[model samples]
Target chain A: MTRMLTFLVVAAAAITIAACDTTGEQAMVPGAKYSMNVEDGRFHNIHATGQKLACETCHAGTEYQPDFVTLSKYADDGGASPGIVDRAACLGCHKAGGIATAWYGGRATR
Target chain B: MVKFIRMIDMERCIGCRACVAACYTENYHTSGAPWNAVIEHEIGTYPNTGLAYMPINCMHCEDPPCKKVCDDMGAHAISKNEFGVVLIDYEKCDGCKYCAAVCPYGVPQYNETMMELYPGKGRTPYENVSDTDRHPTHRKKPKVMEKCTFCWHKLEKAVADGKTDRIGRDPEYTPSCDVVCPVNARLFGDIEDPNSAVAKGIGAKKATQIKKEYGTRPQVYYALVGGDF
Candidate 1:
């Protein structure tokens, strides 16, 4: 009886903590707290926009490593990409002089 | 406000190719491909033919066709910096040859095979050493586009060291190809500075960009050339 009561209390507490985590995801570009790093993306708000999205939906990388980032097919040890994102991955949607500017501003490289 | 450019005086060039050796050492180019080279052009009749040794490299065009094509291919690895230096981002490059195809100067060299700088002799000190602070450009991979960056690392170092004035004047800051010219044929400096050697050479020798008709607007100029770009 004591074990059953403890389990019920723990479950109720876990639910309360989860509910208090956040009211809702916001809509807009990510703020300073967010990071676009590959590991833990700051795409929470983006993800909350009524669709389950994978990185490959936009990144579309190589055959070996399919994402926006082009990882080496040979090894998993090396630091393939240092830290910065490949802005080029967004070119599919935001072409030069289209709704968005090119990767390097004022260049109009495309 | 600085427009960097190089002026090659063909009248003074003897094609020693010392610059090539220097570049090979500086750039870790142990492969079959060369980042800089001298093109030997033969002029006039066979019986009375003459030779011209034209040094060829990335023109660093004002309107680069290479970058445009790379962008179109969606690789977006090529970038022309504010200093007019053209660079290829290796990590983002998908081994696309669009840049190489559209370049009028044929400057973008792709290394398909991996080779050592010295097979029997062993690795270079720079190669063997692990330097986290080394410039990223030095770590370029094979199968990606490569070209003359006008010794961009050196220039960036110069800037970081607050010695921008030392560039083109100091051997440490200047391009290896520019400094290694035995006959002093290759000139590098800001064309915007009328007092600079490159500007004076361009003015005095009537230097012209290669393939101006192509409208590439190449920053590299040739002075006293016998043939067209």
Candidate 2:
């Protein structure tokens, strides 16, 4: 009886270990491992699109190709706009009214 | 003693990433390796939110941890120039990546092979550097640990030509990142010289260096970017 009970316990423990290792429940993102904060979710529209802004609008130089219309000579292979992001850049859009709302991560907070 | 160092003023920096393009072109770096980066970190919540453009590169410390560990591992590839520039002697390097593993700031980038512009499609204009004498500064050895030279080759030329005074002021002597900055946010010069602009600026703004707790004593100073320590 004792031997049989020990064998059963061992088998159950092994199965649990295997299940934990290969479990598909925690499907992770590619570059997310490098991030210390975010966990398991990359949801969009999780909150009110209270003030949705296009990516390229605030975040500059994200366009596929470089914009060559400016006075400065920029190399074509997507290397334009070296002076794109700064503290002032944020205040440019997220100014007085845009920052007034309490953003709860677009609904992820709830 | 130059005590070479860099100062980045967050107040003026616009995070344009021209520094990135400048580094890429100047170094002849392939796509995978990014020598300079402008880190955009969002601070506070929606009502109080703002962004900080933190441009980072090699610290080029007074006592570099990368050099210490590499030498201990019997690879004496890393050496500091007289002007306090930390350099890697490529011939002595064995591509161990030990320096990369030990670095706190993740400054060292490892390359396994020289990447072509279009895989068997030959090289680009920037990539083709067989004739350039400064190829050592621009090119990388496969499987070796490489990081920012602070554009040491440019500085070396400036010094050799008796233009040491022009190190930080001139485009030829200044690092590409410093020269291309649209806002004049980047400042490089002899930190030891109290009269120099970089030194005075550091003093006036109360610039701070990262990882003093780790005792790396990084030469790179930021005016108002590092979190309150």
Candidate 3:
């Protein structure tokens, strides 16, 4: 009986630790290898807006320096005319349920 | 011995926000954090109402309140270099935001998260680009207060590249916003150099600085559309 009780306590502690580690991983933004995605997007969006230019206009796969993967999978799909992005493309990352929407609430109409 | 100055012609400004956009792209790291702001104010009652578009940026003052408050905090993070550029050292800053709180112009911005200007180059957003490709004029830290450096990096590059004569003349060296102005409403150059176009333009226009009562003595001069606006 004593041995069984000790085993049960150790198992519970292990499960708790495992749960915490998994939670931490899930909380992290996906595809965020080096930088926080939110902050990166903020700078990118600001620059695009400030220049009166679109992100896809310069950074599309056709551009000399393309980092479409940083934006969305749509660009990765090799769709032509990446120069002009629409609400659908924007919503992929900035979805209503995404971390970005949660932080900014609603998108600016520009 | 040249003092830098900017002249903004309000009469020619169409409120297209091209200058604002150019400023953001050139200084994307601090882009959303506006160094130049466009405030649209309307005057008059009905059909005769007129809209005034005012673009505001850091004065780079003779006696900057932001610097005074930073000095008072004992941090001394903000200071005016010999060229009259107001700069903040992020490494020395404790993110106390004391400078932001006291800035009458509201130029300082507190960056909470790390942002990568050049993405997907094996660089983390939190990593400071100033550590590697140090901006020719100003050094930037990941998390700190930052504002418009007036494209100091480009200016320094031009000087280093032995194009000192083109400091104010080169469009690439010019602040992105100033260069992108469709109507040629913005002028940038050394104020002390009477020959420079910016100085001559402001002199001819009788340009005025905003909020002169604060005594910031801003380098940015504006030719307002109407009197006392």
Candidate 4:
């Protein structure tokens, strides 16, 4: 009985360790081997007017690309006008009055 | 001291965004982080209007604010490599967002959720790719504040391959964005090399760094849109 209890305890610990390793759920990426603390999700509320998209959501990549054009057209057309966004396309991810809605509201008028 | 420099000719820049894409693919570990950015501003009054496209990357300042603040935390999260490149150690970063807030250029980006490239499936190209494989000169830590390594990985690879002299001149050693630029507006090379195209261009055009008042002493130089008066 004593042996069985010890085995079970060790097995449980092993399983927990294996689970964490497999998931890579730790704050840092697995095997990266560096130390830099950065906020993972602070810009969720910030959204653009035309697309109502956060800068990170679309521009998220390893290196920067200069070919991104979706926002350029909107910027060109709207010129100085605010809020003249494509509402139908924006509503796909952001429902009316969501965090995005408030953010876009301010940018559209700016 | 051998200094490196990047030169941007606004007249030749067509705003293709190749640099932004290369940055994304190379630094996918920080999936939502932007190491390079392009800001388009309209200049002049109505009828004679024009659009100015500015591609901004980490200034790699001589006195980088990001490095100063990171050091203030006593963590020494940021450091300048031997080549004068500012880099962040992801493992030490506590997700504090302090560096991101202090950057005047709004270059550093934050990632909130740890996203798996292929959630249900196993690792994908998006998951396995690192800065080393992407550029060969820049190696980035995942889940950290990653920005442009200025294609340092490529530079390192060139040196290892006994091709140090070929850097900036060789397309493979150049940053993906710089290589893919159809208009040939962006130029990269050792600023210390007097014969390099970047040096010649800078000497010929009187290239200038952005927001010099900030005293960052950015290595990246630019030739303004309007002809020098």
Q: Which candidate leads in TM-score?
A: 1
Model 2, range B1-229, lDDT digits (tens) per residue?
6778899988788779999889877887765666788888777788988777888889888767677656655677888778888888777777666566446676878776788868888887656667445557565767676788999989988888988778788999989999999998888998878888889889988898865545567889988753632
Misplaced by over 4 Å in model 4 are A1-110, B29-31, B116-123, B129-143, B226-229
Order by TM-score, highest first: 1, 2, 4, 3
User: Chain B of candidate 2 versus the native chain B: what TM-score?
Assistant: 0.93
Residue-level error in angstroms, candidate 1, position B160: 2.1
Model 3, A53-107: lDDT tens per residue?
Answer: 4555444445433554365655444553344333234334333355432211232
Interface RMSD of each: 11.4, 18.2, 16.6, 14.6
Worst 10 residues of 3 chain B by lDDT: B122-131
Q: Name the docking class for model 2.
A: incorrect
lDDT over C-alpha atoms for residue A30 of model 4: 14
DockQ for all models: 0.02, 0.01, 0.01, 0.03
Q: In candidate 1 chain B, where is summed lDDT lowest over 10 consecutive residues? A: B126-135
Model no. 2, DockQ: 0.01
Candidate 4's TM-score reads 0.61
lDDT digits (tens) for residues A7-83 of candidate 2: 99999999987665454223322122222111322111111121234445544656634333443454454644454
lDDT of 3 by residue, B1-229 (tens): 7566788988888889987777765665542356667878786779878887877777777767567646645677777766677777777676656555445566787776655445446554434445556553345555667877777777666657866456567886777778888998889888877788898899898888876645457888899875545
Would candidate 4 be rated incorrect, acceptable, medium or high by CAPRI criteria?
Answer: incorrect
TM-score of 3: 0.60
Q: Where is the poorest 10-residue window by lDDT in model 3 chain A?
A: A101-110
